[model samples]
Target: MKNESKELATLDYPGGKRRAKLRIVSDRVATATQGDCLRCARVAVRNLIIDGSRRTLGRVREASTSPGLVILGGNEGQAVRECAISDPCGFTAVHAREGAKLNYPESSPWGWSLANGVSIACHNSIVRDNVLTDCTDTGVVVYCSPGTKIEENHVTTKRRSAIGGILLVDAEPFSRDYSGIMVKGNVLDASGQAMRVGIGIGPSVLSDDMETIINDGSVIGNHLTGDYMGYGIATAGLQGWTIRDNLDDARYMGQPSDRCLDDPVNPPPQAFIYNSATLKESVVQDGFFDSDFAYRECVGLIVEVDVRVPGWWDAQHLENAHSS
Candidate 1:
């Protein structure tokens, strides 16, 4: 029983849990306080239809797309356009299920970090044509799925001194198991690390448990800029991981000031290994491993091993190390 005189607000069921708009009115159909929603139409919870359109008033038109933030969507395949959505607890501004979309909008100020911006867990979902900036945390996150089209989305850390950009995660080791995932034509800027995956260590259905877990995947045609604090692409697993056609440049953006003068290549937290990477690909790999870091700090070091080539290193005994 809500107060009739209180402001009447309408939001899409299950979607607008945080009503962006509030209105108070005069009517005895319901009763109670000043900020509660009116429930005059005695309808069951499931049968109740909150007018999602009624809450679209007072929305200032976004002036530009330079910093776009159109956060609107639900589990269904519908259009939630130019919605000034931000900080809905843990949920991103825009989220969609299969065949759903959260379209582009003129950039408006949400004044909140994209703690977790548009998340598309559903297959065949589209998240494109918008400027997603100033998100404090992950942006445009996609989990394990296929037929997901994530393109032309600009995701950046708005903190100015922020760390990292959009994160693509598929913990599953072995790329061949899961078939299709395509991410092309997107811009991610700023942050400590651009993207990360295969967060933990362990064998993922490996021939031997002694090997590390590897995430089988692909990254193609995505532009990453100036977040050298971490590896642009880190895939730490045993096998079935592919890194082809991704770019990161410090020369154009210039290096960060806080970095050390001698070898500014910072440590990447979790790129276990990228076995599929090759010299032919323009992709560059630079970072100091734990052993290298420890050795430098050691004032006194001891122990040496034979440097002679193993008799088994020849073609007569080389097992799987050679591709020929």
Candidate 2:
């Protein structure tokens, strides 16, 4: 419990399983304004342990207001499971437009964001070894959670509209269903995007309800560097997800050669499945650069693209692969 405004520690309990055990260790929670700076909602916040904390700047430090640790599972129904945000160190950027007005009334200043640098809408949670930096949008975000476990974190984003660096979205409409999720060994760096698992349906829904929002996740061995241009690992309308041994230096600066392209009509072992379990291991890799050359070496070989599921309408296609 350090400097706060709207919240810098909140458990808001109201669901079962002997709820209540919020432990925020080595505190240093930072400045907030429109909320969150450590918020664990509709709690069953059980065994919740935010270790070695240090949530940084909020409230005007960009001003999207909120987030630097937000673990909500609202609408209760119980399930914020064994939470833990280890070795924390979430960083700045939040302003989704303040000086130009339209600060908040939800129209899309990112709908005032659920904000990032660690934001899991709860469920078997576990965001390990954290150290998120310069966040604006995402740097660890797993919304529609389910058996979530984003491991060995170390996200980075050198400001400027930073968007992704470990994101498994579901922007809420509630159908939830991101099975067994587990993005392992993280180390995403970003300027725009890097590692994004999809599902953001909207368009008067109805495609058989799109299997009730399925995203059977499992993105393993992460290590995607970035400079922007997005897509180091993207998926949409997922069915049986499982991208493997990731290690992309985030290339796409207008197709430098193509590292992975596959959107030719829902191709895959029927629809999404890369790297073993008999899916044949391969998760995009092309010489891998980014030491300041911005990001280089991107020829080709592992191209099986087709990623487009931000709002969904009936585009249906996602099964890209890559590796080196």
Candidate 3:
């Protein structure tokens, strides 16, 4: 189906209700394109049980120069699940450029390949209340998008070699400025998944000589849970970014222990520095990063704690890996 948006378009289940008997199971479900991106900015997709699509369940590709595209799932937690979905990047809902709002409330996107389950590649957008699980790559990634909010979402890694749960990156090729962005109130779980990092702020896996400047940004009130996780929060080269009030719930080497702020020599193992970068005027305070776990080194060499000190610690240089 195509939505030119000469008029507002809404594709929904029968009677605008999600019934178990109703299904939109197809190899290609729906694709909405805005021929004139300036005139229109919203497409509502609701109550759809889109199953087994080789491509995305709902796709919107509009002109970046145009206003924006807002793909709303359903009203007030009525969004249904997109299961057994596949694509080159495994995205259940796809949009392009800036000013896009992806609100998939209570929607679960699973069984994807080689990419993020929910990707907000544009700036000036909002992504909230979606649950991502078992995706081959990251769960939710807001790439180069400033003024964006990633909130109240749940992400879990059940797939081995998954690349973290939630990530905010300047990314590669287009290391745009990410200012006024907020990542708050999200839950990331890596249980026995050997997940790489819980939440991270850095360059993409292939970024080189690229610096992502984030001004007035904040990562707060988020929870990272797991035992076999790598870094609860991994960051590098941040300025004007607030990293606080985030907690990790993992056992100390698989045994319960009451340890807070281990010695700098034996620092808390949940937070780390990924690469060499200057961190100036950023606040890292009032958080809990459990204790050392035997599987703490799951992602290889990393510097733990002291992310506020400039050049105090630096670990592992980024190499050009396959595009994620």
Per-residue lDDT over 240-260 for candidate 3, one digit per residue giving the tens place of the 0 to 100 score: 788888877743222212331
| Cα lDDT listed for each candidate | 0.32, 0.37, 0.46
> What is residue 222's positional error in candidate 3, in angstroms?
0.6
TM-score ranking, best first: 3, 1, 2
lDDT of 1 by residue, 1-324 (tens): 242222222345322334343121212111111111233111111111121111122122232221212222222233333323332222233333222322221121121222345555444445555565544334555554345555666655433222234444334322322234455666665443222221111131111222333233345566766442233343333244444566555211222233232342323233323333211222323431221110011011111322234531110100011010
For model 1, the superposed segments whose C-alpha errors exceed 4 Å read: 1-76, 97-114, 160-164, 170-178, 191-217, 227-229, 238-242, 251-324
**Model 3 lDDT at residue 295:** 23
Local lDDT at 82 for model 3: 29
* lDDT of candidate 2 over 42-131, digit per residue (tens): 223232333322322212233332333322322222222233332222332221111111111100011123235445555555556555
Error (Å) of candidate 3 at residue 245 is 0.3
Candidate 2's C-alpha lDDT? 0.37
Best by lDDT: 3
Stretches off by above 4 angstroms in model 2 are 1-28, 31-118, 124-140, 147-215, 218-251, 254-324
Strongest candidate by TM-score: 3
